[model samples]
Target: MSQTLDLSSAPAILFLFGLSGSGKSYVGNLIGELTGCYVYHADDDITDEMILALQEKRPFTNEMRDRYFPIITEKILHLRQHHNFLVVTQAVYKQRHREYLCKNIPNMEMIFIDASDAVISQRLTTRNGGITGASALALRRDFEQPDSNIKVILNEGDKSMLVTQLNNYFSSAQPEKD
Candidate 1:
């Protein structure tokens, strides 16, 4: 179950959606490396315009997520045409995202990296330079992971196990012959 995917036409989009400090970015990168696919992070604002827009919007809401999800969806679809496959990470906790992606995408799989609130808080607090009670509370409240077509990796103290599980999940997602 550890073979590379043959993605010649359009690269399948595997959206890694999980809570903050849940290692979506890190895991996405690792998966990309293992599968030889490019890892795309939608959160980065390379362009100044997008930054200004996000800033003006202020505190992120479900409403903003609703409006912004489409832009990335379209982008991923467009990117698949050129590359063999793409691995993207997003922080989707709402039900609509799960529904929309499953409906529209030809081959899409959502992997929810499950981690405890304590783990997430610890990771954030250590890495964010500084952490606040408010941010921790926000994460607890807002990390709404959709449970459709999801493969959960038990994110405990075992790093190797998590990686193995992720690799297996990708292998399963790729088409198999009888």
Candidate 2:
């Protein structure tokens, strides 16, 4: 049997914005589990060339970012049409990309998940067994803290607690799906 796509059931998205070691994926997963939303990590769309560059200890070049960013955004836009609520984890470092998301998506809310540099370093070290320490450091250096707009900042708490808090917040904040 063929299934029809129901765009009306799709809820608004919560964009998880953060640096590499800032726990976007972990928190997004937890939030998804807690709130029944699907989570998509932008890293999952990393190109083969970008993966090879990172594996070879080369910089994540601008050309790679320019090439892959639109692809990622397109995936998010497509996902928004299908999922009720989607938690998208991405390092939206570029202002233009942020602008595009803000302009295109309806009821899109940005949530900036951040931690201290020391905490991020610890997480990165633990995550990769310290193999990519240099790249982690470079990512930290290149990280840009997004500005406060209509966005939520989550930093001071454990993931479970924060996830619960976010779940509660969105429960009341997000509009009911049709």
Clashing residue pairs in candidate 2, if any?
11-84
* Collision count of model 1: 3
Task: Evaluate all candidate structures by whole-model CA lDDT and list the values in order.
Answer: 0.65, 0.69
Candidate 2: tens digits of C-alpha lDDT, residues 124-178: 7788442276765655565565765645645556655574456445544455769
Any runs in candidate 1 off by more than 4 Å, and if so which? 1-11, 45-59, 128-133, 157-159, 172-178
Q: Model 2: residues >4 Å from true position, as ranges?
A: 1-11, 128-131, 164-178
What are the clashing pairs of model 1? 11-84, 11-85, 93-144
What TM-score would every model get versus the actual structure? 0.73, 0.78
lDDT of 1 by residue, 1-178 (tens): 3444433433377777777677788777866766688788877622344345334533356666667777777777787787767888866767687778767766877778768878877777777432244544554576565665577765765556665575555444555768
Q: What are the C-alpha RMSDs, in order, of all predicted structures?
A: 5.1, 7.2
Q: What is the lDDT of candidate 1?
A: 0.65
